[model samples]
Target: MQIQKINLGAEPSGIGGDSARTSNGKVNTNFDAVVAEFADVRASIPSVTSDLGQSTTIAISQKLFTDTLMSQFNDIGVQGALGFGTGITNKLPTGMSQMQGTAIKGHENWGNYQYSDGSVMVYVPRFYYRWGHVNSPNYAKYGVNALDVKSIYDFVDVVAANAAGYALHRAFYDDGQIKDGFFVDKYQCSNNAGKASSIKNGIPLSSSSANAPFSGLTGAPANTLAGAIDAAKTRGSAFFATTIFIQRALSLLSMAHAQAATSSAACAWYDATGVNNFPKGNNNNALRDVNDTAVLYEGTGYLTAGKTGSAQPFAKTTHNGQYSGVADLNGNMWEVALGLTQTAGSFYVLRTSAKASALTSGATLATDAWGTAAMTASYDSLGASYGELTGVVRNFAIGSTTNQVFSTANSGLAWSASCAGIPQLGGAGGTNAYGNDRFYDNRIEHLCPIVGGNWSYGAYAGVWAVHCYFSRTNGDHHFGVRAALYSV
Candidate 1:
């Protein structure tokens, strides 16, 4: 393929320059004109090089000379765009925010947690933003709209690169702007849920008050784990592997954070007012009050403000945002995540241990990125699976432990035989206020963990909760996914 011409249209420097200029401080109209004329020459070299190969000395010299010249031209363009020369320091780009000063937007400074190694793990804090769509029309009510969008599909890859992390591939780059916002659909998704009807834009707040406007809060948002990821991919051009999903370890860490932030300390479920409200079920809302009945009183009335009076269906409890600095994390839908499972007496999980530092971002999800190591092949050892995977999961959930330390593995395995993969976190239904129920053996066919109690389980939803009762292949109205950005 030919090297694409750098379009310095109007502004000779795409980065920021108003007009082209020379080192001598003269208007560099000549340079721009020359570059434009020879742009086709640079573009055509790809075909020429392919025909000639690299055998002859003359051909090699020509290729190098042309490449160097083009590089110099691009460098000049970048320098002009940036309004600075090479080796200059402390110069801020034009249009940068004076308050933050730093060009980086998504780095979580105020609300963040520290890792064992003393490195800080930043949260995007702001609500999720998808690429390519203009701000949601419901920006006034949702308060999630932004002029720019930032997404990090791979957190491990970002931390590994550290300061130079910007080079890592992300769904949204530094210059990217917020486009379409993915909303939780009020309807459930099936394999056929990929159809047009099921995939409706998120219902805006003012769209319908008679029914709960929040999507996928009670019922599972249709689709398998794989399907959920695919839907996220549709809004962007970036290639994301399984790296975007929440991991078992991260899920537990979030639980601990929530638990610590509460007055009860032991209880992970707390509403906006610090009171524990159960996940809303059919009886809670007029729209959802259908065949299902647990005889429990649950309802969060939408008092013209998009929230309920007693128990809000999908209305984020005030407590959800306190701990993680993220809203609606605890109780809503059971989030499908990357975790462990057992089916036909075989264990399936991500092959490598889920440590933030040991991972790398892949170019594509299906091809070379996520085969054996990213997602492991099913193993024969049911004994190892039960002992290592299942037991650890149980301890983390019921043992009242906080902050399970993550270790660096040498084998590059995301998970070990002794480790039970914590799959999903937070749901809509459960018996406890914190929604800690992992004994649903029927749903745990593959033993995948679903967290944050759903609508069906009132008073049982909390931060350190799990519902590992569903099969990975199964899709319910309670299953949904949350999106995060790595800030690269």
Candidate 2:
């Protein structure tokens, strides 16, 4: 029986096309209409660093997005994107190219190829391609998975307003090899991962080392802050100075916890195995597998010297031998502190109280001051914010036990209908208690405190440590200590 004619138009049957007669009475030669499949692969390591000054954060707030800082951040992308495009120089094994990418330019998972030791260096994987056929519906949906996140041009819109831009450190690309190359690639990030790839040039990370130490130095260009690394290498000092983007750090800290709850995947610390000279051990490319490994997000904050109790700890306690340094939440992150006067009813250990920029003005103590001084990324019951609403306090009720009635969203705390929209109201309570009737899934935080003595580290404290390590040996998971910092 003769084969059915294929519709090369709307529905392509995976196969190229069906035979067709030429209107010219000759054999048809329009076979060039179909797009040729290809693949794109690159390395995922090799980063450039950045810096800002060390001084009163208030002094240099205006310079946050200065050109110098922008230049530095942009360089991070240059190193990560281009560096991974090939591979680091003088590092690959004998058969491997000096700059390593994928073995097959077009085969699926081509760049997804892993080294024998399990050390992953490729920019992205083929799974992005595996998810969809060239013309399938899934392809159109997840097509952004194939974008190069390390590109200086990839992330711009989020930098301006979109909070998701902060979560978009991850990105992917396709260059026709495994998927599609030649700018025909697809991509995605927190929300704007591939947003500015067309026009905006990114700020690089190269300036961080020097600018990190200056006052008012922020954004991607703090010079003085970067210089503090060597001096503050012990415990979390490095974390305090390493200048991690708030969005990046918070997103990273939450990633493991989120994944653990949703997918049961224990967070794997990036060993930095065989990785060297890369800033934050990432080189800026969003392309990464981490294989079974995860990364410690870098973060920075300033602490006042007087804080010794709950007044200073962001997590409400200090960890990693650091009260004023960087943070690695995966392991040693703890509630930290600063400017802690041993006042009446004060046990000061919470870093959020001191180190945090007061959410409001007037420079009041971060402790006990709700919506006035304490600084934190806020969210309440109903996944909303207190500032969005205003009202008086009310009482709480814990419904009858039914498996503890614990909804991750609701936690064990039940609210009286009089309670504000914030499901977990916080004021003066212990552990889970926040206010007259609100509470936290695990208290250490939450505005509802039913009594005196702000108890830091009420529950869920110190689950893991975070850091930046250098990979010396290729296969071994042993991380070479480069510079590390951790908190709670």
Candidate 3:
């Protein structure tokens, strides 16, 4: 049934030219017309179903109904509304702005999303890639592949399918609903009057004192790592960036760099000579490039440098191009990742709690720390599952000549069997890998993972750089953290 507009244009002329009364026959005809129109309108209205499995007749106008439906789909409180689930919101979150034009070219489709508390987050839309063996001779010995591009989903589906069993896909799920994507802090988290922030020119926070920001919140210990986790949580729907989160970001950046390169041979994280694809950052005190001949930036120093800039042709410090990607991921402060811990020469994923006191005591992990038992069971399953044991890398020897790629023959360093084909785990050696950042680990003590070397690390600062030398209680001024948001 089609409902047309009812046009009651003018009042009927009264009988004998009087405006008050109408003839009985005319009144009856008008009443009949009105009844037919209303009946057609009623038939045109669609039925809607409720969550309780009951169908209800809606009598509101069509525009009103549409507005209500859109509200439900855009509700941020809903599990999948903002993430990978239903619909993307046109309304930007507070302090956020969408990137346009060349800034979002290729696989670099993302937006700057800021939290209410001033944490600048970059929205990393979900992308898929297949693991392919590393082609560069510098990285071939490590026996891992680079992340090859498969597909990137820019427009999310209403009923989005879960990305199950894929690398780093577990972090995209929150409470069983698959998220469209996640947000990472654009800069290393800074101290904003004791709260965790990701703003430019803010002082980066790192301290072993019990007075750290967000300390004692939710009964977490006063240590920097625990405080960082609590501080992020206090920002609402946020957590300290986890190893999975960092790994996923790196994977996306790797795929972006590969997709933009002129030759497939350049698809690896680094170029032919092992110079890393991502920016070298402020690793050197002079802010020079890998060759030490060109000055990368003219900033005062690492402590007071701006968060975002273009030191080179692209953003030398950001994960993407100039001012378009996440910043300070190479050589800034060392960002600590939660959920990654190493002890007795094996790495384990910590999923349950972020409380330092409960998880660790001095350099030793508490016996009952969560997820330890399952990770210890099988070696093959280590790199397969989320929150399971990931791969293990043999320690690199200290010194200039020894700080190159992991060579099974020369350096006696090797990646565990489970790490095969994983991107960013192993790559080329020497200058091609960006200062050939060395991976440091200690087999004896319980250690947390700190990635992205600090200033003065020179060739030792990069996206793949990993350091497992610090305990939860030990903190240095160079140690920092980044926050990530899921399902928001």
Q: For model 2, where is the 10-residue window of minimal lDDT? A: 182-191
Model 2 residue runs over 4 Å out of place are 1-72, 75-152, 159-327, 336-488
Candidate 3 per-residue C-alpha lDDT over 1-488 given as tens digits, one digit per residue, 9 for 90 to 100: 33233334355732344221233334434444544644434444443433335554544465333433333322212110111111223545444554442122222322555566667676555443333335432233323333333223311432231232123233444433555566677766655655677776555555444223334334442555434555555455435444434443453454335334533221212343333454556677555555433436545334533233334533445554334367666765677764455544555553322322122222323332323452343111223222112333355422122232221210001222112112223233333423355556553234556787776677777766667677665666566677776534
Tens-digit per-residue lDDT, 1-488, candidate 2: 22223345445453554333321111111211111110011121111111222222221222322312222211212211111221111123322221132332222222222222221222221111011124323224223111112233344543431222222221111111111111100100000121111110111111123211211122221222122222222211212221122212222222212211211111112122311101111111221111111322222121111111111122112111112111222121111111111112121112211322222111244433232233322211222223211232223332111111111121111221111122222322221111111222212122211111111211221211211111101111111111111111
Over 1-488, each residue of candidate 1 has an lDDT whose tens digit, in order, gives 22323335554445542332222122123333444645423433222222233321243346445433222210101101111011111222221111221122112122232222121222321121121123423223212211111223222344443332122211112123321111111222211222111111221111112432222222322245434444333322231212322322233323222322333221223333522332222222232312223222233343211121122222223222222223333343455443344544444444322332222223123221223333442222333233214433332333211211221221123223212332222211222223343333332334445554454443344444555555545555455544322322
Clashes of each: 51, 153, 16
Predicted model with the maximum TM-score: 3
Q: After superposition, how far is residue 257 of candidate 3 from its true place, in Å?
A: 0.8
Give the runs in model 3 whose Cα sits over 4 Å from its true position. 1-110, 133-146, 152-177, 208-223, 255-259, 263-276, 288-314, 343-346, 350-394, 397-435
What's the TM for model 2?
A: 0.22
Higher TM-score: candidate 1 or 2?
A: 1
Error of 1 at 184 (Å): 14
| TM-score for each model | 0.38, 0.22, 0.57
